[model samples]
Target: MAIAAKHNLELKQYDVTNAFVHASLDREVYMRMPKGYQKPGTILRIKKALYGLRISPLLWQKDLTATLTQLGFQIVPHEPCCMIKDGIIIFYYVDDIILAYGKDQSKKAQEAMDQLKQRYSITGGDDLQWFLGIEVIRDRSKQLIHLSQVAYYEKINRLVDDQTIRHDTPMATSELMPREGLATPSEINRYQRKIGSLLYAAVNTRPDIAFATSRLARFLANPSQEHQQAADRVLLYLSDTKWLTLRLGGGTAMQVASDASFADNTLDRKSSQGY
Candidate 1:
């Protein structure tokens, strides 16, 4: 998306109709007829990869890769489901595809899309708006694209509170320690659920909570009242800063920054070789 906005590129969204079913099974497979269509002695021979099959995703991925490769795109190194050729980028998660290319490459983009359509029942082919539940908001005048998970984030934030209270920080200043007290299975599940929601926010658009969520995760096995409060604090923090969106574009370079604590893990204080 950053590249698309940076280059003022054309971004097209597409969905492969019955994506998995388009890939043929590598080996013959048979199944007993489903209840509604069962005949006493009959079995169904499955030729196409079916949705529930374990290898369906792999099969579909391979099929898509072959088609895209044939169209002159090469798999991007170290990136799954990403292909690029001639300044055009095509990446997808399962069947959701986004094709991005600069204005100068518009003709090539359409040609690639047309070739892909021949192999699969493609739909959409419009401006990219939503992908993987994240809303893509574009401001062409400013050449900026904003990614927001507000709809989903709001749904999770409401689980904490309805804005009666807000948090200034995602976690308290004091460090969290695992409880020695026995945790009920229900409590463990509850804590895990909280961490899951927080992790989603952290990964998508809430980097501010990454460290907090990581700290909260340490006590998943044995959560105490304090841990639950910590999780709620993070949730309330989300509620407090709910309107923030992650912006992409407006720059030619991006940087990644990282920091580390001085040996925080308590369980592994010393190693056999060294600390």
Candidate 2:
């Protein structure tokens, strides 16, 4: 995204219709026929990959990878679903695809997409505004993109019923510790679900809450009332500042920053670090 914004590149989104069914099964498979297609003493043979099958995703990935490779798009070293041809980058997850290219390379990008359309029922050629639940807010004039997850935050914030109270910080000044007393199964399950949702935000667009979420994660196995309150506080904090976004753009330069908590963990005396 930074690269796209840096070059003031254009983005196009596409979705492959019935992606799984497009791939042929590499191994023989059989399934019981549906009610409407059932016949006496008849079993159905699966020739094409279907959605519920275990190998369907793999088959689709292989087919798409081959198709992209055939179109001269080289797979990125660490990203199997992301391919690059010249300065244009094409990334896909499951059926959703995004194409990014500068104005100068628009023709080539369109040609590559056109090639893909011939093999797949590709739809959506408009500019990308949303991808994988993250809203892509682009400012071409400033050459920047802001990634926001406001809807996601709102969805998870319902864990706390009372939205009247607001928290300015993700965590309280007091340090979090392991649960000392026994917690009921229901309490533990509740905390786990909240932490799981918070983890998504922390990894995606809420780096500011990473430390707080990590602290709350320690008591997932057995949470106390204080731990639940802390988790709720984090959600409340997010509610207060739901509009915060991560900026990606300006220049093609790399930046890194990290900090560590020195021997902060009482359970193992191990330090926790953030990047």
Query: Each prediction's TM-score against the native?
Result: 0.90, 0.93
Name the candidate that leads on lDDT.
2
Pairs clashing within candidate 1: none
Candidate 2, 106-202: lDDT as tens digits? 8999999999999999899999999999999999999999999999988998797456556778887777777778999999888999899899999
What candidate 2 gets wrong by more than 4 Å, as runs, is: 161-165, 180-182
**Candidate 1 residue lDDT tens string, 30-52:** 99988789799889899999999
TM-score (C-alpha, index-matched) for candidate 1: 0.90
| Per-candidate count of clashing residue pairs (backbone under 3 Å) | 0, 0
Candidate 1's error at 85, in angstroms?
2.0
List the pairs of residues colliding in candidate 2. Answer: none
